[model samples]
Target: MSDSKHRHKSVLKKTDEELLTDDLTHQLALHTRQGHNKFLSESIIPLMLCFACPFFVRSIVFICDHCHGSIHEFLQRLLFDHTLTLKDVLENFFFFKWHWPSAIIIIGFLIYAIIMTMLLPGDEYQGPITDTGHIPIYRNNGFCYYIVSLIIFTILTVVLKLNNLSPTYIYDQWDAFLSTVSTFAFLLCFCVMIKGKYMPSTNDHRSSSNWLTDFYRGVELYPRIFNIDVKLITNCRYGMLSWALLSVIFCMKTFELYGYTDSALITCILTLVYLTKFFWWESGYMKTIDIIVDRAGFYLCWGCLVWVSGIYTLPCYFLVTHPKQLGFQLTILILTLGLLSIYINYDCDRQKIQVRSTHGKCLIWGKPAKIIRAKYRLLNGKESESILLASGYWVLSRHFHYIPELALAFLWTCPCGFQYILPYFYVIILFILLMHRAHRDDQRCRLKYGDAWIKYCDLTPWKVWPKIY
Candidate 1:
């Protein structure tokens, strides 16, 4: 092969050590190996391209269709010729055309969730100790809010269809959803910037004091609005519930366009079951890294608002047009495998929680929960105990949970079929996300646990996949 081709291949095959470095540009460059053939096949690249790549695709196609152009010219057209002007952005902001319905949707859902949270009876559960040496007591009412959201979604879908209007109105209001979600993000960031008086003591660390980064990372550790937990509402209600709601809309749209198929039903059922499982384990979720460890910054807030509700449901959206008629037997097989994966994933988590809660007095696979008492230091440099599990699914691999979770994601989208690559976008992105998350978690434990973490690793003998990574 030519030297240039050899160099390109070498660049693509950068050492895992290089990828593990804290270099954003280098990571971005490596991810570019996943070029424009398809989205889902590219692994982690789809997460970024899902926003920018597809939007420019239509314009690129239009330009190519109208004018003959070489590959270089096409790429140049994609970058230089397709810039979004301020006027177009402003026009999308207005509620005149397609924006009004989605704007109403934004307001209606926000008010309903907020009001439901206020009216619903809630208890308090103190979270893990914060970096600033405080355990935050969060109001726990996500279950009730989950029920209310289901009711609202069902009512709206029925009411709209009964009035000869389409229940899948959201599919046509993509622009509206974008504009409103952006508006929410803008207002919330602004509000967070000005909420100095409301800042939690847990957020005393300003890191570098860079306003842009801090704002993006968030100023408050846990910001509440008038006695309501903002994180629960934004992350759980808005992001998670909106995910389910959008899936429902996509299901309706598919039925409207093409009669119900096993593929569509499977997609809808997997989505609904997964989301319902989320609420069923709402309290268990509160203890997760997103709620306890991560900041409520743009990465989390805007991500949940925009990315989670929109791109997360791409499989269902793709299935709307490319409906797969996977026969009944295939559908059942896919679902059975998917549910088994979900159960394994859930059981892994349950085992860990049980070990921690019972102080290693729990059973794993009909035997005692094998655990090592790992001593760790908190952000405040104080000592704490972390029960490092060595039993159950964890005994198979350090991150065996993620393996099955990825499987669950794949099986969930199997109905989308293999004809087009778009439907498996979630599966690819999720695997990459989980792998990255696992690495982060590993680094975090290494720092916090020090020698204890090293010992735990020695005992476990894996980071994610055993004997591979």
Candidate 2:
């Protein structure tokens, strides 16, 4: 009887496996068919529609707020009555044709992609499920879509370069093209990707006052598409887009400086490298980091990459290409600042991670305290815990990482030469954003740690910049 029961259990397990395998195979075949059909539909689409986008944008020169009057009346008022100049007309034309439309289209596509991807079919059989008790197949699809978009955008950029289009021409138009295509591709792939669950479902409620509940709530607002949560919006799309846009601007400025030089190539390479890094860090790699910190969002990462990295480093390329235009002393100073800032930032992160690994708890001053509980989901739906450390660098300052970050920003913006308002805009923006982040963080900590946080704050009072905030 005992032998028969054991054999029955083994047979049931095998049956489950067979069922899962068949389901997966059927889904794969369906996806292949769908892909072929999609490709055919796209190929048969009219070429005129594809080519006519630029011209169509150019033709619809004016966009009017249709509150009381028609577009014709609005244009007449602005052009004739307002005495708008040719420059004004040109500025409005580009802004409408590219800037506004691109922003709307990209955002719309991302949202739609995320939603559709979640609703698609698939299941989790191999890995641990997420909070929804399913594998994160949608999140994987979102990542794939983002990668495809980036490749498409890069190709378009290369094509523009090959055509010898003036920097100004590319700058004013390429963004729109990239944005449109990326958004479209994201939507396309999102519609077809297989689904999987990353978290198992559990109804065991130990208590209503669980700390994990608060954390989960926080994660919800952390900004995600479908069920895939991306913690850092600024670092991913925003940062990459900012760099691309800055590259266009830099190219124009570089042309004005040394005509055409190898410096331009260097700048392009660096920009691409940074963009690639942004994607890598924002994807599953960052998700792994979340497992450690238990803070799975990209808010801080996004802010650093987009506002800080994009605004600062990208402009330096232009300055390097045009040393004479920016002056010698200023250039050297900017480069020095950037190098130092990067060094400090890396050091801080390295120290923090090392500290966490070696010590089971964070050490403030010389005293060690137990903190940072690890939470995981198992098949039977129960919580488990393990110890995490914070000994080395974290003992020094609560947020030593913020120092290099601010420094890097200051260094990158230095090359703008303080000649125009746009150049220094980065510095102003970073200061404001960081300050806001610091304040928000403070509030969160205050709520989370209560007396324990108060003690931590007492030990290390400097939020970001030491002795400044």
Candidate 3:
């Protein structure tokens, strides 16, 4: 094994960037040898860490809320207060009762979404080519769907005067809503795994021998059911729409309880603007890591179905219980920060989309844009060129958009104060999630573009933070 030892020594002598490139290449080689798609990993252990969140993190959050949003009081009461029995504690903190109303509502929403997809008129957009030479198609009806859904919701609550369909109903029944969503998400994950394994709807699939990985990591990149795009429905329509609606509901709840508060108003406005921007840029998002790289299983499906609803709305949810007035000065400061962050995030995406759409003939900051002609090969040995924008915010960091995203989350949640860490949960989780995504995206692009990706990385070394990361 002298040759092997010599090779290892040679690798050890390489520069950091070279070493990273070699490691990425080695990982791809291993995946190829293992008969797995080199583009999508067989094991998603890093992502699967989120699996524990539903069981553990959510349970703790529920318990904290149950104890009136006081973690210390909850612990003290649990340890010292012998009035609570084991059964009572378990039933209250851990066990979730299946509320028929919430369950039916969630199911109805899904069915309604499916029906809307079938009936709605939307522009057809083609996605990036997959490893299996399939180009997935998506409907650009997200913004229209969002507007229609909001109007209908408003009609149901204000015009129809249905108490059950009130805006604050979901927040009122938070635990039951969460329970129904988690159960549905779990069952949906199983169905997608089965479909990907035996009844794949598209040629863009990569099934592994391991069923668990297939279940968690997903076997298909773009899996459709009943002529509707599954990712488009679950991610954009259901999950994201739910997040927006929940923000409105939480704000309504806060007003209903504590009257008008600038904190809630600011939070609600910023959240809507952010989600509106998302719908406005929905087509561009289809090429992102969530849709393009991650598949349609537990990590994505369950995440959209459950995590987005539960975790992403943590700030708004927290404000419902702990409503406080930040007055004018602090509120204005937070609002300004949140708005600026949203604009930066939007501009970052716009810049990249403009550069690519114009084929790098665009201007950045009123000057000619700088870009790299990065080339990559398709699975069928066909070569293609991609313009990598190295100007504007992109020059600051590879994933500079994520910085503003994090800042926006923090700015909105900052009004919750530091009395308890519950409100900061969204910011904390988003930080970890974005950091992982940035790294995962770097590795994926490195493997896809090889030397060209290496050149881009050399030109932009930072992942998400400039001069720091």
lDDT of each: 0.67, 0.42, 0.79
Instruction: Using lDDT, rank the candidates from best to worst.
Output: 3, 1, 2
Q: For residues 178-236, could you state the per-residue lDDT of candidate 2 as single tens digits? A: 43433333332222111111221222111113222222212222233333544433334
Query: Which one is best on TM-score?
Result: 3
Per-residue lDDT of model 1, residues 390-419, tens digit only: 898887778888887788788878787665
RMSD of each candidate? 9.9, 16.4, 4.9
**Per-residue lDDT of 147 in model 3:** 86
Candidate 1 at residue 320, lDDT? Answer: 68
| Residue 242 CA displacement from its true place in model 2, Å | 5.2
Looking at model 3, the pairs that clash are: none
Please say which candidate is ahead in TM-score: 1 or 2.
1
Which candidate number would show the highest lDDT if scored against the true structure? Answer: 3
Q: Give one digit per residue, the lDDT tens place, for model 3 in 341-430.
A: 999999999999999889999899998998999765555555567788888999889999999999999888888778888778788889
C-alpha-based local distance difference test score of model 1: 0.67
